[model samples]
Target chain A: MRVLGVDPGLTRCGIGVVDGQPGRPISLVDVFVVRTPPTDDIGARLLGVERELERMLATHRPDAVAVERVFSQHNVRTVMGTAQAGAVAIVAAARHGIPVALHTPSEVKAAVTGSGRADKDQVGVMVTRLLRLDAMPKPADAADALALAICHLWRGAANARLSAAAAKVPVSRLPKGSAQKGWR
Target chain B: MRVLGVDPGLTRCGIGVVDGQPGRPISLVDVFVVRTPPTDDIGARLLGVERELERMLATHRPDAVAVERVFSQHNVRTVMGTAQAGAVAIVAAARHGIPVALHTPSEVKAAVTGSGRADKDQVGVMVTRLLRLDAMPKPADAADALALAICHLWRGAANARLSAAAAKVPVSRLPKGSAQKGWR
Candidate 1:
């Protein structure tokens, strides 16, 4: 399964794509970041995001998309930022007909670092280790996105197995190419 | 002078255009609403907003654009909504090279109702009376947007007068049309 994970923001967004099978190690297929100038018009900024996402979708063709769910707090300005970023990511996935799964920050952290309360640095360290990377993912947002993808991979596998077991039928009874469905 | 006002939203956006100068009563040149289905792709939704705004701009050839300024708040989801809406409006204005001005809700309310704390119903009633219309404007968003435009005109005129007064320096030392040049 190939999963595209996105960390959305108005000024900067990070995208990561990973490919792997359900019980096997996931491999990073590609990773990149997009940045928009603060002075640019809002339309131009959104266009930049759309163009980059379109290119990533075309090139990687990930089967599913995972995005960080935004939760607003007291700061109206921060809330606006989170909302714009979330909207952009959601729109990008929706545009491609990709089923999107939104994960909370804690869920992502727990999946990647084995602790829901893990800090950014902890999550980054664990993600690098789990992915067997040469170093920690640069720019915390990219690492967070990758961790989100890894979380999906792990959860997806668990869900698939549970689904197969609950069906009270052999796993082979499922669709023949179902394993390939999640990956583009 | 003509002013176009936009109220941006995820599923539906409202638009209104008015023509007139400050102090003198403004006329409702046009008022309409545009909508995008939730199921539509983000790009398509944006395109819809763009197309509608462009059509209005072309048909009316407004001299200025007025948009609602998003207020920062603690609610992430609400902020996101406002930001997305704001982005669409900003993009539309920028695309046509129109001079865009953002007005706060309170400012618009005060301009239309003579009280910054006016509620929507009060504002609507005041708008009707101010425009000498027979009935309240339809579609609350559109009415609010129109009020925003009216607010801009009122403020713009006051600003113009202030600039003119400030420019009454030694006439010989002043550049011709300097005040007008700055306004433009």
Candidate 2:
């Protein structure tokens, strides 16, 4: 399965595409960033984000899209930025008909670095190692996007395996609430 | 000057247009809301925002756009929504090459109600009185957008007067560092 991950922002957005197949490790297909000029009208900047996302979808054609869920602290300005980024990602994924999944920053960090408290650099290094990249991703946003994609890949595989196992087992033999209990 | 005000959101965006002329009260040209499907792709939804914004701009030919700045709070999900809405507003204005202005929720409220801490209902009531609307603008988002435009009109005019006054003031009369402190 091909997964496209996004780290959304108003001024700049980071995008990463990863491919995963049965019995093969997830591979980074592409990574890039889209930016909106500060001097441009806000409406135009949103259009730029939309257009860039459309272009990415057409070019990469990933099976799924993964994005970071919003996490806010005390700063209202930062919260606003986080919300704007989340909205853009949601709008982009909804337009394409590709299933979209949201992962928290902590979840992604843990999946990539084996620690939920991992810093951006640590996550970047782990993502580089996991994807076998020659070097770490340049911008921290790109690295976060990659980590989000990796988290999805790992969780998605686990979900698929559990689904398959359930399919083979008789309904009576399965433990109660087993379906609801795993990998949400 | 004609100004378009936007209240952006994932599911619905509120838009209001106002015409501002010298020595006359601001006139409400039009008001409407745009809705997007929740399940649609993110790209398509953003396109929807773009298309709706373009239609508003084409119909009204606004000279400027006014938008609310995002405020972060304790809720991550709410912050995400605000961010998305802000981005959509920014992109819409940018696409048309129209100058854009941002106002905080408190600033807009203060302009309309003389109190930055005023609640939405108070602001709505004040907007109705200020614009002489037949009824309070329906939908909180629509009212908020109208208030944004009103806030811009009030502040923009004040800013212009301040600038003109500063331009005429003699440098010799001003205290050292006073120029930098004036109307920044």
Candidate 3:
């Protein structure tokens, strides 16, 4: 599956595209940052980000989009901008009927580096190793975005497998006291 | 000037359109709320709000758009939704080349009810009277939207007048302590 991961921010939104499935090596399709002028009107800045993301969505045509779920940051203004940028990414994916998933910073870190509390350097190193890249993706945002895409690939693939396995099981063969009766 | 005012929210986004200029009677063009199902995906919800806003912008063809500036509310989730909705409205206006202005809640209240601390009821009553409507706009959001529109009309007109007056002033007539020297 192809997944486009976004580290949404008004100043420099990181974009990373990865192709992978569960238990497989992920390949980097594309990586870049979408930046808008800081001096521009807030509306214009958002529009700029949205336009770039829309173009990426059309260009990459990923199966799913993963966005960093913005949490409360030190500065309210900064957090607001982050949240708005993330919202734009989500809407862009929804417009194209592509599924969108949000991963928290910790989740992405844990998924990529096996440590939820991993620092930027660790995450970047792990991403570089996993993608077999000669050099790590520069800028923390870029590495974080790749982590998000990788996280979604593993998590979503696992969930899909679980669902499929459950579907294949016969209801009559279910053990007693199972919650399967609720399915009726 | 024609203005579209939005009181942004996820559950119910209030929209109000008005037409008026400085020192003129403001006329209400339309007022309504755009709602999205709460159970819907966040991306779909934002898209729904954006669609309604775009339609309104096209139909009304407003010269300017006024949106409420969201601040931190009691609920962080609610505030995030409000901010996202507001961002969508701003983007819609920007796409159409319409100038967008943000008015704080207190500013809206003060512009309509002569008191920044006025309650919803006071603002509602003032909006009803100002628009010469028999009934107050239902739901606090609707009234707040109209107040935003009215606030924009008056404040923008005043600012324009100030700019025009400043332009009309000759350099020779400027005071020695005036900041116009820096402006030049």
Residue-wise C-alpha lDDT for candidate 3, range A104-136, written one tens digit per residue: 888889898898999999999999999999999
User: What are the candidates' C-alpha RMSDs?
Assistant: 7.9, 5.2, 5.8
> In DockQ, how does model 2 score against the reference complex?
0.30
Question: What digit string (tens of lDDT, one per residue) describes model 2 on residues A12-117?
Answer: 7888899987568879999887887766545555677767777888999989888877667645544455456556566567656787777878889888888999
lDDT (C-alpha, whole model) for all candidates: 0.74, 0.76, 0.85
Candidate 2, residue B28: lDDT: 85
Q: Write the per-residue lDDT of candidate 1 for residues B1-184, one digit (tens) a residue.
A: 9999887665667788988875577898888777877665444565566568779988998888887777655344444555666665665565567777777889899998889999999988887887778899877887887898889889888877877787776767667765332100
The residue-by-residue lDDT of candidate 1 on A73-160, one tens digit each, is 5455555555565556665666577777777789899988889999999998987887889998889888988888888888777877
Cα-based lDDT at residue A18, candidate 2: 90
Candidate 3 CAPRI assessment class: acceptable
Candidate 3: residue pairs that collide: none
Please provide, for model 2 over B1-184, each residue's C-alpha lDDT reduced to its tens digit, 9 standing for 90 to 100: 8889887665777889888775688788998877777666455656687678789988998888887776565355554555666676675566667777888789899998999999999998997887889899988888888889888888888878877898888878767876421100
- lDDT of the structure predicted as candidate 1: 0.74
Model 1 CA deviation exceeding 4 Å by range: A39-47, A156-184, B10-12, B20-25, B33-65, B72-79, B92-100, B130-132, B156-184
Off by over 4 Å in 3: A161-184, B164-184
Model 1 chain B worst lDDT window (10 residues): B175-184
Indicate the fraction of true inter-chain contacts that candidate 2 also forms: 0.53
Q: TM-score of chain A, model 1?
A: 0.83
The deviation in Å at residue A114 for candidate 1 is: 2.0
